[model samples]
Target: MASESAANPPLAGKHILLGITGSIAAYKAAVLCRLLKTAGADVRVVMTPLAKQFITPLTMATLSKNPILVEFFDPENGAWNSHVSLGEWADCYLIAPATANTLAKMAGGIADNLLLTTYLSARCPVAVAPAMDLDMYAHEATQQNLRTLARRGVHIVEPGDGELASGLTGKGRMAEPDRIAAFVGDLLREKKKSLQGKRLIVTAGATIEAIDPVRFISNHSTGKMGYAIAGELAGRGAEVTLVTGRTSLPTPAGVERVDVLSAAEMYDAAVRAFDGADGAVMCAAVADYTPESVSETKIKKCDGDMCITLRRTRDIAAELGAHKGSRLLAGFALETHDEEAHAEAKLAKKNFDFIVLNSLRDAGAGFRGDTNKVTFIDRAGREELPLMPKREVAARIADKIEKILK
Candidate 1:
């Protein structure tokens, strides 16, 4: 048993605060607690009053080997369960089987229960695994609440798509116990301050070049990839500045955001920020060209074809590379044909330390998607990667940067 614990010590000696909410999925918390214990974590269970109806506290206590906490104080002994103390004691606070009501309350800052109160007081990282009916999960209000939490740096373990308690087939099932445990372990295992004191600049999204007040030119860049990179760098303790174009995505936690509308604006922002940055990731899909002149008003509909003169926009990555001086600069290339050749050319022309290449012809490897397939090109050669979540790709990028820094 000792050797087994030593063999998988990613979460060993860590304090975990497990909050179970009111949902039929609460029964799964028992298995989760056991798995966490087997992984060598010190597990403490906090349950909502309603959660007791779904699963008994005794079962949880037996698995976790700790007393279950349901109320603010123990009535039998009159011992107070200090939410602040619990919050301070944990390394990570995980809420599983989070119902719509609990999620809404959490979003609204209503801390009527011990678990919610602990959440409000927790200085540790927070995560949630939502469990509810498909309809409730799909509701806009719930999604907005989830987004709000995500913006605040709460890790959301996305629910799986499968049969629900209401006999509906869709999302909103809490992730399985083993998967949840692995996720939490991964979070705890990450080096929290690997790039401390370093500063990085990242540009993201589609730059809009206006031809008229009502008409503009832009690509399909949604900024997901750039945002993920920024978040990853921030997680590694680098002070990140995100120069972003128009997109509704929330700013990553711990990142400074500079909003811009056009390619020229993004160029100015990225250049200014890069002057103080230790490195930069050129992830924005900046426009290659923009209109030479702007129309003051919306162009009236005409029967004849219209033409607008365009000129090349300033190259942000090239300018940064010209002044790179020992500073690291990474660039991205999205191509349709001769992908490797184009990427290689850009790698040399931009003076990038390395380049990330993704081809449009490859499915699930382009803009406006959560997943990407990429290859890393450098003077040392290439490293091909499989299709993965953008967040994972960001981690790989961050890893490379760390190695370079080392």
Candidate 2:
């Protein structure tokens, strides 16, 4: 069960794909299905056959108003149920009580069932709440699988610690249905209220500096923070234009999204939106330089090696800073040495009103986690925020933007 406070419910008019796998907590999927329906989302459930051993199909079918898909083809007429079509149909894909076996399959590319196939084929953001015995979850294999899935762009809803079905418990309990629903609603609804009437632009992910047709240099950003910020802003009320590099992240609600591959493409998108935008958050880790000349085709790997010359890409931040007076411009700096000095220098040079400085050395602050410990530095001074989830960090950024445009 979630704590005392209930999140605001605003998940109306959204299509949610609920994937149910085999686990003891499968029964809770029914209640979760109900909660989702009550909150205004269109729910559809796809279950692994083993999942039916715990929860009846009729129960989920009644709540979702859609036939539960379990097999690739119907046994009667062999009518096909395409996973790709299902993936594209939903705004978000949710899997509650995800089992250890399923997680392993997901991590290793074992598409033996309809659920796994759909998950593999999903284009929407996938959120999984894993459920298993304490020992099964504590095993190294499980942890590794979770990390692999996370790195592969799957959102793992961390399981709660408590009593388990085995009568021995430390963790691995599935979160309560109401709380799970609220969490999903919060995840989806977070930005709806904040960005409703405003207009903003978010540049996210790592920009590629192509060395040749087949190779490029980039960072390990994965674009999580930037994408999260964009989704949050759109959820709140703002018209968000998310200009993202190559990432598997889905388009957030009520946002006009543009996809790009390189710094040049991202630069083009950012400048065009800044033309009439109220503000912008340059959150991408843009490559500092690009290969001076890209080989038309893959460079042959022959002889000792090769030296590829590089040239600086146009400064997108500088362009916006020059014209961004009444407009609010926010920049993100992932620094290593002389953190504050570098951020402040860039703050002045890039003409950013504020720069979010995160030191890579700091634990849980830099990249690849749901949390961050950051120091927001602007012209006034610096305010160090406690380590918190990236969602909260995004909220603080939104709060600052509200103050600016208000």
Candidate 3:
């Protein structure tokens, strides 16, 4: 394909680390690697010992123009090929033909091999495309492993349903190389240009209110949904500034990140960014109240019970609503009771264009997970979205923004 005729392959400049495991689909990786190279990405190949039974290291090395690393150390001199360095070097770690065994190891944190070790150390995004025989793919163990990896932040490139290696037709075939490349390109592109020209500010995670420097009140908010939304928005060509309270979640690609602590700090950061933003998603679980005053030092644990004074924290959304005009404001409410009534009141009071509501009663959602099932409410009514990956949830929110802005 001509450089211009190639549709500006989104893989260009992506440092893609390819992992080939023991599977019949391993052969397809050669073509996949070549296509990735043609698209202008820097490719590096990693092989499992079993992978050698299917494909030659020399073949992969020649195709990638880089040495292949299959083990932690070279057998000849015992020189180390550091998994840490490999993890640090790549922009993305991709496993094509990821076998059920590898998926189980990845999900279970079994680091018996170099590939698994590198996976644990990788700082960038990890995506896996599984390939297997029909029955093996549909087994309960395999399905559980896949879900475990998904929950642990690994992207599963869903396998296509078709003829399998065992001559049975089912959903075990790895996606075609070209389609996998396209999917990866979309993933990378989603992190880069999808939100261009639109300004978005998202608040995420939980706020910490101090009773003293040594003690603070917080919650179980992982901020996965908020971070995912920020990432998807940035990928779609939006300039995003993420105003967040404390959370372990990494900052999304192509986003300007701001970290805050107490609700007061969050309020300050969010309102400041709202001015320049075309829209804002208030997703952080900010504390409704905080200690009225702080002790100069840690409060000593006494034999008797103690009472502390509490005060209402400034309502962030309401303050923003007072000033936000025509800007698409999105709010999230986690309700345990009277879900609709509370959500509706919040929408009207905060002047949000729409509100996303999820219940504590719902499974696969809330804190510390990748999946979310939500009900999105606009002034018109509600749309109940099925349980979906948080990333998909982000896509839906971005789609709504696109509709409103368009």
Candidate 4:
């Protein structure tokens, strides 16, 4: 196990602050600390005063190789345990086996304990694993507190549904140590600032073609994939400019959004933003053609079919490609047939560094879905990916972008 852990240390050099609250499940914190240590993380344990009854500080300190912190100051020596300093040192703060009382206190901003005070001062991502009886877990107050914490960007590792300490066979069991360790590792991995100081442009959603005042033509794009990419890049410390068409999705954090209603407007916005961008992801489902002339007013129902001449819209990707020069340009191809061939052609024609290809025939690979199955096509070759959440896909894309930027 030691050799295996050394071979795959995902959290190497990461500083993890582990918080243990009062609960029978506090016993699991020792195992969690060991697992985190095995994964090459520097672990520090902080315990609530009430937690000492269930788990000994000596055990945690032995596993973590760090002194246990339970109080603000040591009465024996008058040395201080600075919560602010601890908060700043940790890459991530994890509260495992968090009791209902601890959850409530965290949600309410109560900082009576050293762990709670550290949580309040921590600037890093915070995660909690709730553990309690089924009744306490299912109560509306608890649920509301969880929701409130979630809205405040707290990562919640939901309790498992199994035998509880209360002798009831239901939900509200704290997740096992292995799962908690994996969650912390994954969370810290995603928080890496690989693209820091880079500037990126991303286009998203379906561009509309207006035929009348109240009627317009658009595709089924919900901007989920593009928004995910923007969020991923921003999370990696990139300055992102999102040139978006019509979509109800909220702007991703740390991304500057430019909203447009039509393909022409989107083309203008994207082109302008790309001038100062280091790279661009063309993910918008832009219209190939738009009405040459729109009606002055709403077109009433007519017996004969109405005819409106259409003209091609400006190709945003091709324009960006022409001016991309040394900058990276990535585009998406949503195809019904000959997916690879079309993607490759577009990759060359638009001078894209690579193209993401998705076939309409594949289930969950198209627009309006939270999941996607995609293949990356570049001059080197192709890399196919399995169907997964849009966020994961975005991460993969961001990883590739980082390689190019580096």
Give candidate 3's root-mean-square deviation (CA, Å): 10.1
Model 4 misplaced stretches (Cα beyond 4 Å): 1-122, 126-184, 190-192
lDDT of 3: 0.88
Reference-based TM-score of each model: 0.84, 0.65, 0.64, 0.63
- Highest-lDDT candidate: 1
Report lDDT (Cα) of residue 183, candidate 2: 72
Candidate 3, residue 69: the lDDT equals 92
RMSD of 4: 7.3
For model 1, residues 261-339, the per-residue Cα lDDT tens digits are 9999999999899887899999999999999999999989889898889999999999999999999999999999999
Any runs in candidate 3 off by more than 4 Å, and if so which? Answer: 1-17, 20-44, 48-185, 188-194
lDDT of 4 by residue, 1-406 (tens): 2344567688888999999999999998988898898899999999999999999999999999999999999999999999999999999999998999999999999999999999999999899999999999988888878867865778877677789887998779998898888768767765778899999999999999999998888999989899889988988999999999876565666788899989999999999899888999999999999999998899899898878899999999999999889999999999999888889999999999999999999998898776899999999999999998787899999999999999
C-alpha lDDT of all candidate models, in order: 0.92, 0.85, 0.88, 0.90
Stretches of candidate 2 exceeding 4 Å from the true structure:
1-21, 24-49, 52-95, 98-182, 185-194
Candidate 4 or 2, higher lDDT: 4
- Residue-level lDDT of model 2, residues 82-113, one tens digit each, is 99899999888999989999999999999988
Q: In model 4, what lDDT does residue 166 have?
A: 76
Worst ten in a row by lDDT for model 3: 1-10
Candidate 3: count of backbone clashes, pairs at least 3 residues apart or interchain = 11
Q: Positional deviation of 116 in candidate 4, in angstroms?
A: 12
